[model samples]
Target: MEEYKKRIVKTIQFIDNNLDTELSLEKVAEIAAYSPFHFHRIFRMITDETVQNYITRKRIEKSAFYLALRKNLTVKDIYHQFGFSNHSAFNKTFKKYYGKSPSEFRKLAPENFHKIQNKESKNGQIDTVFDQYICNIENLLNWRNMNLKIKVTELQEMNLAAVMSLGIANVEPSYNILIDWAKTKRLFPKENVKMLSVYHDSFKVTPPDKVRIHACMLLDEPLKKQEGEVFPETIEAGKFIIGSGEVTLHDFEQCWVSLFLWMKENNYAVRKVFPFEIYHTNFKEHPEGKMLVDFCIPIH
Candidate 1:
């Protein structure tokens, strides 16, 4: 495994050295001395992305620097230089990876660059490299040490498909099962569905992993539960303070500890509902598995 990892690092360095060339998995596998057939699996296991995805991501990362630094180059020239055959292909891939087109990125480049630098270092900070490292550490501590208080409100009715589970450790499995069920039922929405993680754990003394979690959705009130008759639970709606951080479900205890501490420090009361998590993005997209989830706890 160490040998395979070293080979992957070397292959990635080669790709970095020759991003302008026509690179493919077969070629990369050859560089790594691994079979082309087994290359994708190795890449996925080691990097959590397919070889093609990795290449595209690297291309986008490099292009981001160019978008800021290179003014004379047209998007077309950029695409051609990056080995993308046409502008449209380049535009599509850029949008998919960066959520913005090349032209759009170029237009916003200067302002975005300054804004990012400033916002990232509003506190007395040195360079962006150090600022980012400090921010990450601060966020991690905040996610672990912040206390949370509970409040109540009346929630508007919603239509949703969900998986209901008792213990917090079951949250991940329940969430995956609900997603799978949504896929099987063809209920996954492209643009509108506000994926939610609702919680209701009355017993305060329960261990963090043993706390309950319900992977749910807030749907239009009129739609009824059809295939799976998970309970039509009502979530009281009101102004509830929520804190979010980038952490995995397996490390959820840290977040909970933070929330409890925050609540205690602030003199806020705790509600019975288990704090729920909404996974907005898994870090599978990045080489670093920096997964981010928002923990919504009903607080006073």
Candidate 2:
């Protein structure tokens, strides 16, 4: 079961990386080294959506992200970029999910699209409502009080053995499990091993209860076999904007928000890859109960 899940995760990562290309069931199943029929059934069982539905939904969500935040991209440019055959099809699908046409959504979503409710009035009063409620991304600068040291640097590729944790509430337990596995495998040394949590979905896009993350331990080399739910993954070498600081639990969100604001202020474009954290100190052992961490976002 663990090995099966690992394969599915690998395929999901492949799908995310190649959203602009053709992704048939056969092609995706090959990534998992599974027969298409079996892969389809397993995928539905695990992710609760058919392969095509998942692909379409992801494409729509990505398109929505661009429409809301990337003002430089026109509606036509976005639709074509996400692999839609034509504008008509893209509009129809987008409206079915978001209850608004692409242009209408673009007009309304300034900072975050998820906050936009589907309660448009008959008399264009929705514009007034949106104006009152929209959060300006510039306001995120308020988090500067956290005094995070942010920098842009190149990161080497890494190999990891990871355990999936669904929802924020389950993160600690997943990490505990991963640590125990490492102990049994003699992967830990006298010094603290590097631990990381990779975000596979955006908090702004997915519901908090349904968000997916991986609790991972950096590996010197790939593991020979899957142990329990732990499986190997690799983070590609890339340029990243990183925010490093000592933060309490309450400070995590603010740190992330500030990093994104910093990225925007410095004119950096985000790459379509997972953002992650590297833990340098365990909060439980710190005198002030603060964890030293580095939050890294891949950039184009």
Candidate 3:
């Protein structure tokens, strides 16, 4: 199982690195050192998307990001950069998913985006990196005299079918809703559905009324369209520090607190991208069993 997972991770990395190049089943399978027939089955089981669909979605995601986050690049440049053959194809696909032209999205997003950033950072006083929320001494004590096993890895871009939880009092209810949604949709075969948790706000910094969390499933298929709150998201490629442990779910907050302190102590600056958790075991299936979770924290 570990060996197969390594191969899948390798293929995911390969696809991310070559998003600007040609990618095909036969080619990607060869890169994974597996026959196309075998690779297709495992790849879908592990990732939830057919090879072709994953590439298409990833290309669209990269282009949309360029449109929104980058000021210098034009739509035509983004079109070619993501390997789209022409502007027409890219526009059609972007409109289908985003329901707006690239220009439309770029304008709509920034109106609310930077304001949110400023609000998160402002502390009534002058804005500083060590805001009152992050300067707590108790959080530092959580890491003192503690031993942790950490692995720093470069993870490939991950596309998720997520259920957004905004202003939820606790993370558990959101996770329950996500798992139930997965079961109703037949998205879990143990091997196919990977239960991942994404934290978009700092509990210490963001107020409970404004916190953001996502309960997500890694895909082997394109995200199914639904009228409910489920949405699609992509975490861009980056280097991350992974910390793993088997612990009671209630103690999970400590895990992150410890890691943040560890990052500060080691002089590692946190990346703007959110931190996420990848669960290795299904805890609902085993109440007595603690979870094996990897804290995927982006770093420079």
Which residue pairs of candidate 3 clash?
Answer: 47-219, 47-220, 48-219, 48-220, 48-221, 49-220, 49-221
Among all windows of 10 consecutive residues in model 1, the one with the lowest summed lDDT is: 125-134
Each model's lDDT: 0.57, 0.79, 0.67
Candidate 2, residues 1-300, lDDT tens digits: the string is 666777877778788788899999999999999999999999988777798988887788788778766777889999999999999999888877666788888887765443444344685332212333233554546455445888899999999998887678878988888888888888875376899999987665554654689999998887766677787778899999999988887777767767876777788888867899999988998888999899999998
Backbone clashes counted, model 1: 21
lDDT of 1 by residue, 1-300 (tens): 646655665566577567789898889999989898887788778666688876775676556545654566677777777778888888877766455677877787643332222112355431222112223534745545543223334444344556555455666776676667667656664445566776543222222443345677655663353344243445555434466666554565556545544554565554433356556665676556655666565554
TM-score of 1: 0.42
TM value for model 3 = 0.50
Looking at model 2, the pairs that clash are none
Q: By TM-score, who's the top model here?
A: 2
Tens digit of per-residue lDDT, candidate 3, span 1-300: 546655765676588678889898999999889999999998887655688877776676556545644556888888888888987898887765455676776675432222211123243431212223332556545443353478778998887877655455646776666677677778755674577888765543344544557788887665745324456667889989888877668657667766765665676766758799988887666777677788878888
Q: Whose lDDT is higher: candidate 2's or candidate 3's?
A: 2
lDDT preference between candidates 1 and 3, better one: 3
Is 2 or 3 the stronger prediction by TM-score?
2
lDDT of 1: 0.57
What's the ranking of the predictions by lDDT, best on top? 2, 3, 1
